[model samples]
Target: MAEFWERYAEININDRQRKVLNKLLVADPDDFEGGISNKKHISMTNASSATATRDLKTPVETRMLVQSGGGRKARYGIDWVGITS
Candidate 1:
């Protein structure tokens, strides 16, 4: 399970996002935070925010697109919280 965190935390997440994951997912896997979504999501890297649309512009598309907005559309995958391929 430690390996899972290594992969997930590798993504550059904001302070708020970090708190969410650390509290909700990593620290207590069974603990559910108020209003925090346990849906499919990922932590984004600097590259994502730097993109034109904050989207990964590559021939090989990524699982989750960049979400620059707040709420659900504000998260992007960075293989940190990503499932190992």
Candidate 2:
């Protein structure tokens, strides 16, 4: 998620994206089923511009619901920051 916060944008994701992101947020990062394997993944592909990152300079909006710790760390709060609940 650090990579995303460094170069991400403010995106208002749709319904499907919300559901998928919700599932992936709390789930373990290493967990296979926890990733974006749900039906909502397609929506992410369709709306590439919404979440896709152009480069380090260009910001890309991601759907990260759960965030990390403090101390100069980056928190990816998808439902909270990326997309409003």
Candidate 3:
């Protein structure tokens, strides 16, 4: 996981994005269905809801994170295979 994180550093992600990814990496796979939400991100990163939303987008777009649900109920989880492979 450390190696994977180190590899990601070359990309243009922000500190919040890195923090979110680290959280996802350690989270249980069973919890992924109802995974981390934007509100959680806001709390974790101490950023605004809008900032959390934007921070999440880059990982989703890059396929490092997988998004589910929609709107206020949206949740996110790490793409394990995408990261490990």
Candidate 4:
């Protein structure tokens, strides 16, 4: 939605965050997790594990991404309503 994009554009997301967000946006719901881990982000962005972790943090804080689990088991997904509202 244009509203969502506008709000997203106002955020201070970096390249990694943008990439991860795009992946999550287009991912099939069934394949969303694939497993609760940051490896998905690392593989998608070719980023280091630490970089992926940091990249994900801003989205979570801004409610663009919802995070669950803990540590290496953590997972992330798009917050559809959060963004579009």
How would you encode candidate 4's per-residue C-alpha lDDT over 1-85 as one tens digit per residue? 4566677787888877776776666667677754325888888888898898888888889888778888877887777775543
Q: Report the Cα lDDT for candidate 1.
A: 0.36
Model 1: per-residue Cα lDDT over 1-85, one tens digit each: 4554555454554454444334433444334322222142223222333442322332013322233345444333333335553
Q: For candidate 4, list the clashing residue pairs, or say none.
A: none
Per residue, candidate 2 scores C-alpha lDDT tens digits across 1-85 of 4444343336555555544444454456554232332123444445443342221011113334443443223333343454322
State model 2's lDDT: 0.38
Whichever of 1 and 4 has more lDDT, that candidate is 4
Report how far residue 60 has shifted in candidate 2, in Å.
6.7
Residue 69 Cα positional deviation in candidate 3, in Å, after optimal superposition: 0.7
Greater lDDT among 1 and 3 belongs to: 3
**In lDDT terms, which candidate is top?**
3
TM-score of each: 0.31, 0.30, 0.81, 0.81
For residue 58, give model 4's deviation from the true position in Å: 0.5
Q: What is the lDDT ranking, best to worst? A: 3, 4, 2, 1
TM-score of 2: 0.30
lDDT of each: 0.36, 0.38, 0.82, 0.74
